[model samples]
Target: SLFRGQDWLQLNLEELQQSTTISGLLLELVATRDIREGEEILLDYGSAWETAWDRHLKAWTKSPGMYTPAHVMDQVASKLRTDEEQKEYPYADNLQTSCFYEYEQDTATADGAASSSKKKKREVTTIPWEMSRTIFDWKNLRPCSILQRSDSHHHQGGHLYTVRIRNRPGLAPNSRIPRGEMHLVSKVPRQAIRFTDKIYTTDQHLPQAFRYPIGIPDDIFPEAW
Candidate 1:
């Protein structure tokens, strides 16, 4: 971490000297004075580091409201019922607008020659807001295979199963999780999706590369990630 205030320690470098052997380089920090107990240790990174830190602070800005762990921007955009509201949206810059075109081929005869293809007709339209948002129905999802079932009986009257969302054609790509990825979901005999009580007792149970857990509601999160 870069500190903008005064630092307690100073950085110093010294060369190592050896007899009847090759010398090596060494780096060390010598405290100017005694440091109080439980006091934070900070280093003076010099004028160059200070200048860079100042520049970063000047350019840094708060994150946009539309940014979230699970991208729910479409849901927010869908709330705008009228064109006036869509035009006046404060975060309209985050939404994407694309033009879709439909083309029709036409055949025409010229100078008694064989039928020739000509520029027939074309129609261009923008995707409606209703169709742009992704509607995920958990009830429609099913287990990928029978082998995905777990033998763990932790959830009373419920079973743990692996599930995934089928690929949907023409739908916008999800920014969070990719398509066809498996996820753990628990469900009772006659109920909607329920939360599972999966816990890690040891580091070996965790994935090789994993991110720290975030505080996000299960409803907002996509079915699979």
Candidate 2:
């Protein structure tokens, strides 16, 4: 295929990390809800992809890589094998950061056939992704997600991360994952990886959605944009 002619080009999406506008807006809203450190946060992969692409366009004024369709597979190789890759991902069943990105490599299949096996994976990077970082007032900053994990994922059916902050569960009044709900998180594309998506709502619907009381300090964010 395309890589047959060029191999290094396989590193196409290596440089980008995507985040969505809705994510940015919601993050702010989450922060206002007094989000504390180490809360499990989850955003849509598609939205994240869109954000990353937007970042690329803003800079290059064109698609970052694709580099085009020919090389796209090489860019997203790791995520294919769910069981294997998912096991390697950071905070797998816990509440910590989750990363979703593709890495290039050579591999084999079941039939003893040798072929290219690109996989998309989720894992934690070297840089510790802190959920608190997003609360700062930065203009046009890069988009990423971080969380305070609580439970752990064990071989057997073990308990998940408790998702605490400063040793407290209710620290962040309005949690990235609703107070009593389960949150699905993964690692970010770039170095600081962490980790979904569905449902849409306008500002007016905020109250009934998460239901964190208004004006609560370190509790929940303002409903209006």
Task: Name the best candidate (by lDDT).
Answer: 1
Candidate 1's error at 74, in angstroms? 22
Residues 36-61, candidate 2: write the lDDT tens digits.
Answer: 69988664445546666566556543
lDDT of 1 at 91: 34
lDDT of each: 0.31, 0.29
Clashes of 2: 40
1-225: candidate 1 lDDT, tens digit per residue: 243311212212221122233333233355789989999996555566667667756765655334322134423332212223345543333232211111112101112223214432422111111111222243232222121333464345544333222232344343122322322222221122222112231222323322333233444332331
What is residue 167's positional error in candidate 1, in angstroms? 22
Runs with alpha carbons beyond 4 Å of true place in candidate 1: 1-26, 63-225
| Predicted structure with the largest TM-score when compared to the true one | 1
For candidate 2, the per-residue lDDT at 161 reads 29
Report the lDDT of model 1 for residue 166.
Answer: 26
TM agreement with the true structure for every prediction: 0.22, 0.15
